[model samples]
Target chain A: MPTFNKYVQIEDKPSMVPAGLEKAITAAAAKDTRIIAVLEDMGFPGMLWFKKNCPERMIECGIAEQNAAVMAAGLAAEGFIPIINSFLFADVGRAYNQIRQSILVDRFNVKFIGREGAWGEPGISHNTIEGIGSTRPLPNLVILNPADAVEAEKAAEAMLQYVGPVLLRQESSPPPIKIFSDDLPFDIGKAFSLKEGRDATIIATGYMLTEAVRALDILEKDGLNVGLLDMCTIKPLDDKAIIKAAEKTGAIVTAENGTVIGGLGDGVAAVLAENLPTPIVKIGIEDEFSQSGKMSPKDELKEHFGLRPEDIAVSVKECISKKEKLRKKRK
Target chain B: MAHHEKLVKDLEKKANQIRRDCFEIFGSTQMGHAGGTMSIIELITALYFHHMKFDPKNVDWPERDRLVLSKAHCCEAIYAALVELGVYPRKTLGTYYCFGSPFQGHADRWCTPGIDYSGGSLGQGLSFAIGMALAEKMKSVVKDVNIGQGGFLQRYVVRFDPLYRSYCILGDGECHEGMIWEAAMFAAKYKLDNLIAIIDYNKFSLDGPTNEIMNVEPLVEKWKSFGWWVTEVDGHDIRQILDALELASKLYGDYRPKCIIAHTIKGHGIPAWEREHIHLGRGAVIMKGIEEGRKKYADV
Candidate 1:
């Protein structure tokens, strides 16, 4: 196991992803009785709140993830919107076939809440980094990775408003800093520009958006202006935003708390490579399976994975230099 | 009970016709699941012709009872039955498995009419049926408040008659999947009395015999242990199947789901094809022999 001394201390924030999701579901259930929440063996604190509000709609489906997925599809088939809650590895990884066949193929109105991302300390088994990659190829699935509790709540409500299958990935650890205001306009398949710059663009998603903001601050201190874009929706990607970013800033660096292979980085790169060939650098876990061991602090893990602010600054500088070299070669 | 004999005879004739139609369809396609399709002819007939309430004109009627063919590969029997009921055109049967045809090899609700759920992957329909049953249970409760001048007359009337039931036909081989047992535990725990599951215990699977491949024996006891009202019957006998279904329907709202283990042969109608481990591709050869004027069975 690798270790690092550099640790980014997260503030003691009270808001959490599960709490926000539960609050959103409870509020939505009051308006629409068709909303049903199905739980696996994993206990969600939101279940109690939902049960207290809508007692008859709670379905405790035990530890069987496969059955839970298909049961949700069946409920959706009968015009009831079912939200299934489970760990990311268990729900999206284990019951992938059921989600693909029964839910996505039929376009059933089902919502899946996959808790715990690459930031959790419960070891690699509980920490899921490839959920977005695994579910990205499935047709008719809307994938959302919320940056913080506020975005999580908004994403939950947005999923309810949408009428098809959705996979909303919720991080296990809460972010110390708030990224979005209370009145931020959130929509599916849309990207939000946090900061504008012309030198290079740092497009990030999920928890990495916080790190991207910090990196942008670091670059600004050096008098380098770097643009920052928060991509919440992975599938049905905001191609227009990405193309605009690439055209405005000739260099791009994609960051995500997932694997670099088929996650947000590859998704952005695929569009940019086809639309406009820009010099891009990806910042995420390389091609390897993460291990389970002693828990490390979030900052140390970021340093260990080369995901710190300084590391991102280094990649952004490299991307800018690469773009310069390509320009000179063209001349 | 005097008219029971006539009902049984009529159902038997319909089942025989469906079996013949299934074999002919498979013969024409030269590739289809005839064994399992033939095994569930009587059960399908009993449900579509006698027990289940469905309107051929309106396939999406909310009050109509739903049937999910969990053994989806055996869709020929369902297609034949639908054609007989006029839900699908008679000429569509000839276009089975052809390009751009509505009649696919598997039971896809998106492609064909009267199919409640799409099923090609097994071990999923039971859970889907439980979902529909749960929906019906939740929708059936009606809160009626009639306020008079003196006081308010509030009555909670649960109309079970209008509430539709969900029936699923599963294959014995499909039970080998772990999802089936997971669904079973869930259905029993919720006490979904509106859901009924009928397993076509045809003994043979795609590769070989179910017992030799993977024995799912003591099926009745297993269902009983899972807290289901278990019943065993001769699947080919229309009266026994109908009686089991009727008993299952009567047990609605009892807080316990029903399971009927129907013991049946692999190739029920044709004696020559019986005892053979027949699947999709294997049926075309036997069907070809029948079409080539090889009369192996006098009755067929």
Candidate 2:
């Protein structure tokens, strides 16, 4: 197994994301009076904390995601930094045109906290895997999907500090184990390399990073040395880090909790095809809707979608063999 | 005539001039949103020239009242008014709809000055206007009060009065969008009296008559049900529009949003244009309308 770096401090206990988001936003709003909370009908876990602490800053838009989207645009125009929170399908999907025409066209300063991923009981309606692909093409919008609690808090703080449009995805997997140390040095458009290997490298984003951490162990047991990279900022993908990983390993496997169509896999594939031409395999949900599944000892959805550590280990071996075949042909 | 009468007479002449200018700009492009633009001449003229608070030189002054044109398709009227107020050069009117022109087909705040919100999509402006109005209520102007005792200075915070209002103009056909009612309920729930919305009830949308396409009849009851202080006026009459605006502004402290349904006809001013429900007049037909408009409104 590759040795974990200083940035990797995987704790034993798992923590919920809503608590982390609440802490970060509460700290940011305490100092900046311009920050306001604009929420839809389905409130987050600690939404009442905001209403209790800063009642004047809370705005209830009530089931009308379209109205809330345009209303936040208006509030942003008047210098109030409004943060809208909802499910990805409701906030970004139901109001896609409003976000594009009203918000992105003028590039309003609005923050969206969209929660969507797989392996939950809400099923396809709430847990859509298309948010990443759908929002990728919109101009002037930065998309961030943090891997764990520490990274989530840092991404939220960074999103608040930046003065433009940003969408932070809180993936809906069983809560990820606390993975990063407190002082991880997070930036908007950079990636963090967790381990280095010669055989192959696995680039992971969102909750899939935790699975990749486990996949590294599985590969090591099978006598293959693999590297791990945490890709938090999906947009403005860190070309240097991706190219370095490609150059070192010559084979790549991309992992995400969503679709492979336009998610992190496509982004990495395009980067490799244009720059390095490395052997790559994308690991994500196929072209179909997600259904209800359990996350117990078996983890039914992960098993069904082939997103377990065993699945990732299989893909890694396949990628490495592709690289070995290419070398043999050249010789 | 009395002084008030003279003021009304002057505003009427200004309205006539604004109508003629809209026709001339439409003729320059040989095509434009002639019906809705013509219908809102008196309402737009009353707001920019006679009612709203703005500086032609400093367009982004924080305290200045804002105009959120939700039905941005009829941007020619706003452009003509901006030119009249010296916000843009008169020559800019000739470049309407051309590339790199500030007079975009829609009312974009980034491209054009004197525009508060960028709008091309319908049913979004009222919500945007409500946002500005809510923000204005929350905005504060800070003043430092010095309490000096033994050469020691202390500061105190005091509340400032409301400085500006947000005026939004929407089209009757645009009411078909469900987002309009969503905004309507929101403004009422917040009791945003600082937001004023005026509807240009010109009886037509893009396809055909609004009633035949999708009837929005019983419109007044709809606004009243949505909790707005509603009123009706002749959109073409300068006195009526001015009086309604003045009344709406006076009700600011009453804590209720206002909606004025100004009844109007498609292609209102020129007889040749008014005979047909022409949403976008073009070429020979618009030229004929311009020829007729010059005879009626040029000298005045």
Candidate 3:
């Protein structure tokens, strides 16, 4: 087993995604009185934190995600920024129409923090990997998926600072690697190039970014030059960075901890197919329902869905060979 | 006549004019929500012309009261009222649903001036109203402060009226949405008394009778059970709607949101369509001929 050298040793605990979100939101509420935290029944430790710190700014809308969504729009209409926290299935899946019609149509400044991906042994019902794909089609909605807790905090701040609607997907199980610094720069539609090379480029998002970095390290040991790009923003995709990567590498592989169908893989593929026609490979769940078991759901699901870093490295190698074959055929 | 009576008479005239304009606009479009729009003409007129506090000149004024037409398919009526209120030009009504017209088929807050909330999808308005009401509650309060000057202290209880009232008009058919009840329970739980939800119980949905489509009977009891102050009114009677609104305004301090179930026929004004299974956009082609003749004769 290859060691993840960049990963820092930290106490294993529940994800700091919610904790970072609560801290950032509470701090923002202190500065901006217009900020309000709207919660469905799903918000846990974060809800408790908000209630304790900024009780006046917190709105518990019960388990009704639909009402929670529309109420956030209404509050936004009245010059208030309402942040909704719920599971991905409840917020993005159930309230998809509400977000599309009420929020996005009017460009309401409502922020949604959707807890996504498998964790805590939750069944397939809670293990939602399609939220990014589902919400990506909505016009006027900014989709942000942070790779780690630090990025999650910055993402929370960025969502609040920006106007209009934003859907920030936070992983329930935080990545073991701390890829970003405490004060790392985070913009709404900008992609972060973690490493740069010319042979092949790996574009990844959310939990899969950490895995992509690990795969890059593995490929480097084999004398294969590879680049790693963290595509945090899914919608209004970083087309500039993607075009740059496509032109430089001519071989692209997208790795995501989501279904390969409509997630980051499809997004990057569309950009490359349109702009550069690069040979591409996608690494993610190949259209299958995730299973829960006694082992850590995150590890089991990642292994079961072929989201391991080794798997991504293999796909990248295969894509590079395809690019070589295409070059020879053209010659 | 007394000032209140004169006001009522003026509002009644405005209601009739709105109904006429609504019919004319829907007829011109040959595709508009006529049945539900006609049913709630008097109630909406009472709110916009008589009860609600709003400034057409400053439509985005923070202190202005808001109206959420939850049953937004019936946007022709709101468009007529908005036109009459001078928010938009009277000629804008002629461009309803025309290609590239800002007057969309449904009530869009962003596209139309003076519209507080967009409501095409049903059962969303009540929640939006609850949110506005909650914001009002947060912003509006009486606070006591002490000021010290020259070693002398002065205390004053500075009280301000609530920011603004939020009125949401929902259709009986819209109540079938589970989110409506969710909003109902949320508003009651938060004691959002400043929010008033008026259900236009016209008794007909898109398919057929509401009872046959999906029974939403015991509406009053349902709202009451959800902790709202329930009141029933003849939706066609401007005076009854005004009275119910007045009662609702008084009940604000009781810490209960108000629900006024306005019983009305599907098409209250148009005789041929009234009491029939008149869903939205139906009978518009027939009404178009009548409207053209009336306009030609200056009979509005």
lDDT of 1 by residue, A1-331 (tens): 1111122222335446665687788889999989988877565442545656665667777778899888888889899999887787887788888887778878999998887556555777877688888889999999998887777889999999999999998865435366666666789999988776789999998878777877877898887888888899998999999999999999999998878989999999999989999999999988865554333434556666787889999999999999999999999
Native-to-model Cα distance after best TM-score fit, residue A91 in candidate 2, in Å: 1.3
Cα lDDT, model 1, residue B66: 91
The predictions' CA RMSDs to the true structure, in order, are 5.9, 5.3, 5.3
Candidate achieving the largest TM-score: 2
Model 1 chain B poorest 10 in a row by lDDT: B147-156
Candidate 1: deviation at residue B104, Å?
Answer: 1.5
lDDT at residue A18 of model 3 (Cα atoms): 62
Candidate 3's C-alpha lDDT?
A: 0.79
Interface RMSD (one decimal) of model 1: 8.5
The alpha-carbon deviation from the true structure for residue B150 of candidate 2, after best TM-score superposition, in angstroms, is 49
lDDT of each: 0.80, 0.86, 0.79
Q: What are the runs in model 3 whose C-alpha is more than 4 Å off?
A: A1-15, A43-46, A118-120, A294-298, B1-4, B141-161, B282-285, B288-300
Worst 10 residues of 1 chain A by lDDT: A1-10
Model 1 accuracy (lDDT, Cα): 0.80
**So what's the TM-score on candidate 1?**
0.92
The residue ranges of model 1 lying beyond 4 angstroms of the native Cα positions read: A1-15, A173-176, A292-298, B1-3, B142-162, B282-286, B289-300
